[model samples]
Target: MMRLSVATLSGLPGDIDRPRYDRAGIGTGVVHLGIGAFHRAHQAVFFEHALNAGDLRWGVTGASLRSPAVHEALAPQDGLYSVVTRDGAAERVQVVGAVRDVLVAPRDPAALVARLAARDTHIVTLTVTEKGYASSAADSAAGYLAAALAERRSTGVDPFTAISCDNLSDNGGRLKQAVLAAARQSDPALADWIEHQVAFPSSMVDRIVPATDEDDIARLAGRIGVEDRAMVKTEPFRQWVIEDRFSGPRPDLAAAGVQLTADVAPWEEAKLRLLNGSHSAIAYLGGLAGIDFVHEVIALPAARAFVAALMDETAATLTPPPGLDVPAYRAALLARFANPALQHRTRQIAMDGSQKLPQRLLAPIIARLDRGLAAPALTLAVAAWMAWTGGRNDLGAAHAVEDPLASVVADALGKATAPEDRVAALLSLSQIFPVRLAGDQSFRQALIDDLALLQEQGARAAFARFTGR
Candidate 1:
């Protein structure tokens, strides 16, 4: 069995697709943080298209902030990997060669900083998730950016655009805040320079890249007759929308199906509230009912109806971008969620609910309240999350709940055994909930009633009642 690398690419079966561009001629102009499955399936794939179109300056160098696992996987292969887009039994396989190198931040922080400082590296992108942003203490991503910008500043190098592909609203603004805060801690002068010169452009990325498992690897290997440990599996659908503002040169990504817009806020809000909001609902409620995969949950009558209702309520709170069809978008999302081949896990999406809920569910809920409307479906989704954070499901089975605020959730659950008291305790955490909504009696009672129903009956019954299915 030959290892999948540039050296082995020629020996690969001619039936498989390889990079169309000259891999040797490509330069590493982009440094991406958190080169996980999602990045490989989304951003890396986009750059591969750009490279194939003769844009040699956009080759990416991926850097890992915490785990060396991704570096270990790709470095051995010379930064080559395959992406399999599955649509039912159909699979489209392409070997992506856009990633020129990968580095572990802990092993060689100076090298990482030097890469960011390099004149060739004009764009810095990140896929670090919502919790990756630092609200209090500095995070690794911010710290690295601060150091890199300091070096670039001292050396008189031009600043690069910082693009955040996270699901958070106004992600660019949020990331800028984190980087500036981190830079300010070391040198306020450097922070001031960064604030004026650098550009943090918010972007929205959509793709269903599930966590690759042994089965996916084996299937891919069977198709290509090679062992590539860094293979990523995703759905056929993909979308990227970036803000047009940039501090320095950037690739013509518009030719690569990327929507370059002056305003990404509308797209971000719709995606966060509708697609992400329903995803959280499926995770908490569906996982509580012992459902494993997203498709399985969406297949259920009650779950499907609940999600549809939830999206409808969320859409009411949003103003769709011009020329966008809200109903079609909703339909497409449901179909995407029901992608049987993807096997997106409920538990995987359920992680980091404490950080995720404020944007995905809470924002829309607050919007409805501001308009003096009751959001029962969104309220039920929150109640399901409360039950999920209780550490046991409706089946009386215990599962480990992974969240940044897991300890706080545990403490909240421990503080009260009653449904009303539990809802009160969780809502009292002003960080997660807005004061107006949390203080609303009707909203609180909606959560309390649903929580009681979920406790007495199972998730299915409660969902059925909530949706009147």
Candidate 2:
């Protein structure tokens, strides 16, 4: 079988939307870090639209910071991959050619640095997730960015905009902080130059991109009549809201249906607290209930009600900016979650609870607690995560707890039998929970009670009680 590449693209079925632009003429202008499935299905789709609209400079050179898997998959195909969007039984496949190259930063950081230093590369985007920030400034994205910015500054080339497509709150500001911190470690002058010259624009990206396994590959092969190892599966609903702050020329993303806004905070808060918080809750509880996909999780009466109630509690802490409809967004999220074709796995979303909890669940939880309001639904999700980290489901099957702090979480749970004792011990870890929030007697008691309930009755019963159904 022919693989999906530039040569084979022309033979693809007409219904499968291959790139309309001339791939041979497209030049790399955007350097993306973390060439994960989410990047391929979401941002790369928009860049393809940019290319199709005849902006040849929007081609991407994606860098996989830790894994060579993406490079190995896409490089042989000329960075060509399919974005398959699922809505019910219907699927739309588009071959995105905007990504011209994939670089493994670990194998050759110098190559990635060279691409970053290139004068035509006016924008750099990241979807490296929350845990990627943990490495020291030298090896992390911050370090690489600092090195690239220094080269650009020395060579008298213009600085590029650094956009963070990660879900963390104020990620743009946070990236700037990390980059400057790394830069200052070597040369204060370089840090100063970055502070003034570079623009770290925050962005809010929303799309449920399921990790493509062998099954998805086979399914896509059956649909497109080709082998695309780098293909990604996603939901039809996608969004990207970027702060309208850039150092120089940028891809006409707005032309491709992006929201280039002045203040990305409101949009960020809405998605993080409502959609993401609900996702975390469902992933943990559904995983415990032995539900495979997100739609199946939402199908359970108890789980559906719990998700609605949880979103309501989280939404209470938000002050959405004008023109943003909170109710509509919440309703849409439930419908999106119930898209049966998406097959978004609960175990997949359940990964990295420690890294994701702060912005997704904890901040809203903290907001409600500080306002003298009970965060019952919010605390229930945290309790689910604690239960998930225990490594065994109600079905008596063991699953890996894939978190950067798995050891620390294990040590925190060490030899503790009682739910209260376990809850108090885990809460004391100030890395995930705030110092004051950890010590708060009311918050501590709530988590203790929720954990006790999960232990006593199991996930479904606990969710029903949490939602008062």
Q: Write the per-residue lDDT of candidate 1 for residues 135-232, one digit (tens) a residue.
A: 42333888888888989899888999999999999999999999999998889999999999999999999988889999988888887888999999
lDDT score at residue 356, model 1, on the 0-100 scale: 93
TM-score of 2: 0.98
Q: List CA RMSD, all candidates.
A: 1.4, 1.1
RMSD (CA, angstroms), candidate 1: 1.4
For model 2, where is the 10-residue window of minimal lDDT? Answer: 131-140
Per-residue lDDT of 65 in model 1? 83
Candidate 1, 379: how far from true, in Å? 0.7
What lDDT is obtained when candidate 1 is compared to the true structure? 0.89
